[model samples]
Target: MFALLFSITIEAKEIEEVVVVGAYVAEDIAEPTEDNILETIQPTKTFMLGGFNGIQLSGTDTKHTGVFKNGVPVNDPSSGWYDFGHDLSTGQKVTVITGANSVRFGSGSMAGVVLLEDNFGRSLFTQIAEDETKAMVEYDYFQIAYYKGTQGSVKSTNTENDWYENKTFKAGYDIFNIELIDYYYEYDTCYDSNFAVSDDCSVEGEKLNVSIDHDRFTLGYTNNKSTHNTGYDMESDRTYADITLVDMLGHELGISGQKETYGERERETYSAYYIWSNDNVSVGYRYEEDEHIVRLGLENDGLRFSVGNSYRLPNLYEQFGDSWVSANPDLLPEQGYGAEIGNDWVSLYYYEFSEGIDFDMNSYSYVNTGSYISKGIRFQNEISLDKGSLFVYSEFTDSDKLRVPDYRTKVSYKYLGFNVEYLGEFDKGADFDGREIDDVNTFNISFSWYPDFATEIKIEVEDLLDNKYEFIPDYNSGGRRLKLSFNTIL
Candidate 1:
């Protein structure tokens, strides 16, 4: 095992983006406009169940993860979780960071951050400036798409059939740009509704983004609104602003603030980050109203080391919501510190591999007031020969129930545009309602075929081995189930 590890890490660069918990480039997982990129790329070992149809980071109970779009946090202010059902057809790329502690994202970043990027309008300006064709000079684009999905049922009463519609437009000139999107989704059966079966649930939403770029500075604004209707009703409205600057001395600065109103409550947040970079090292500081974070690191060639401290405030729902469990107004915010080491290696035979180890300690455990500690190690290896390539990834996490996974391994083979992958996990035990649930093995397999450069059809099966497990007692895992997706860009 050590020889295999050594051969893989020999060519690894220290400053390389750690695949397990660091920045991820969207193109590596799927094409732009693809759906569920998070579900496809990140190993399940990093996430646990979120109610029904939601995903939250492993090891943390409440939603401490922040989902940022174009540098602004977009997670539901009240619940602190990004709506997994939100349409992403308009997005350009996405980056997810898990178990990360940073000062730039203030309140709810104890678990991690997910950044969604969309710069279609800005790209159009560059295209017009570079293209000589008359047809390419206009900066206007519009798109419309529809998708449908179905899944078998666990309960005898209902099956899951879901579909959604999407439309978007981008238009603007050189110094300024605007983008708009309209989205809608409906469920055939009231399977996950908050009301009766007769009143099937549906959602309608709209988003608008405007930006101006000049010299070394940029300014932007975003507005989002959504409505959900069943027997009961719910609605949300969010507004946010961002500013960024790059100075002559190689310093980068950014600040963002937001206000979100949901149901009968409203809240606001503000955060900023600044960093100085030189040839071999970088230093940075971040501040949220509730927490302070700092980072100091040095990278020489491909080897890197860094240490940092992070703090997070309790979210609105955890402080006020009344549901299956009541809120605790006296709850204290969680704080922690962590460090990482990484290396990039390349084998003489051209096989490439990378490895990273991370250690984290928190002031309080999820859903409990006691201190908690966790350690994680991850590896990725790739070998290419002829027209085919083999990729392997594995991870191990030693932590408590909310975030415990003994081990996970994934392997994939790609050749001439066809790909197949398998993922499996050995999960630790969890407890609910004072009863301890048994540990279990989980398995999944996925296949993808790209008939051409612009089309993709995929099939994925979850829990292929039928190992029954639950994050919450009586809420058994979705057993062997099948899902299919057809995605394309015109």
Candidate 2:
């Protein structure tokens, strides 16, 4: 009874103006064109720049949002933060929403959301074997990566130390209705001078999912566990059950419940929703309730809007740690209400002069009565021709004084099957009491090529101007660097 429609619109004419969904375009005409447009639109800094690797370019204290494999909610019971470091292989698509977006999402969506889908193509191994439809007998993929960097500046003496390692594995079995995925990540960093700081972090987790389908209904369960070690060690375990009612007023009704435990803090959430679509509009509402928590959401077309309120209960660390040296024992859980509104649109066919052009934009705002209010804007555009394409984007955030530039502009073009790009970041400086802080600027270029029946090759030169832009205050030293990479499918 629940009907879900998936459709793709193909434009026959040439591309003219390109627009990216949930993205932004900078005001500068000199900005590079090859930059990844997603970075310009989404609120977070984490983005896939072609390879399996993604860059967490900038840091923001906002909640990240992500979608389930089937476009369902992947809610977080504790802090409502979406962990982007997890395995992304299951994701068919990823969209990052920036800033306070309560009006568009719900109460706790003070930061932004990351929407994910599971319909993307298979990995190299899956494609080569041509067996993506059937489960593999054994895990068939593996990869390893390592990185190191340093920093230097004029305002403050400093040293940079950072490193990371990551691994992932996946397998499935049809007989048992089982699928498994495991992920691990480790990172360490040290900064002395300017502002003394040191952090050592590691995270490891696995997810086991099982489902059973019948004539009228479906049932599924998922078990997830993750361990984190930073200044302190913490572990989280979650179990969830989902049910689908096939015949519910010409629509599919879904209900889910989850229980999560972290240290001495425990919480439970229950949610239910109905989805259906016609030729013109798609509509649905989701309702969720738990201890000190209540949320509801509505959706139509490419827009999902929601609102809710929640109360944070004190955790074991906050309720018992020493105040003088350790955690604060008197800390209170954050409580607030929020809402969000958003949408996405694509053109099947438009004017000829605008051939190969696409456009996308999103703007949102949110307020926490007990905390702070925030707003953000993101836009992206792409234009494609016979030779290649061009991309442009921009992002901006406004607080009390618009203290940070946070704005970025980029462009990319392709010719003869080769792609090139340029990127730039705006100056984000603030007048602390009265004195003006120095703002930084940066420029980078990269090229990639693919030959017949061979691997893809890439070369990049960063900080071309050698401008001492401080990604973090006085923590300069990104400096100039050249990088090369090669990728092939077996």
Candidate of highest TM-score? 1
* Model 1 agreement with the true structure over 1-490: per-residue lDDT tens digits: 2233223322211112222322212233323323344554454422221123344443443355566554445566555566654443333455655434244455345444666544332111100111111011122233332333322222224445434554555554443545566766654444334434542557777766665433433455656566666433444556666555544585768776767665676777777877666655666677777556776555576665555665655555556553323545666666666555555421010000011111112322224355655556666667896888988877666654353456667777887655666666665555433555445455656676779776566666656776655544443344565555555544
Name the runs in model 2 displaced over 4 angstroms.
Answer: 1-61, 64-79, 85-92, 95-113, 117-157, 172-231, 246-250, 275-283, 290-371, 385-387, 400-406, 424-442, 474-477
What is the lDDT of every predicted structure here?
Answer: 0.49, 0.38
Error of 2 at 118 (Å): 6.0
**Each model's RMSD to truth, in Å?**
12.0, 12.2
The TM-score that candidate 2 achieves is 0.57
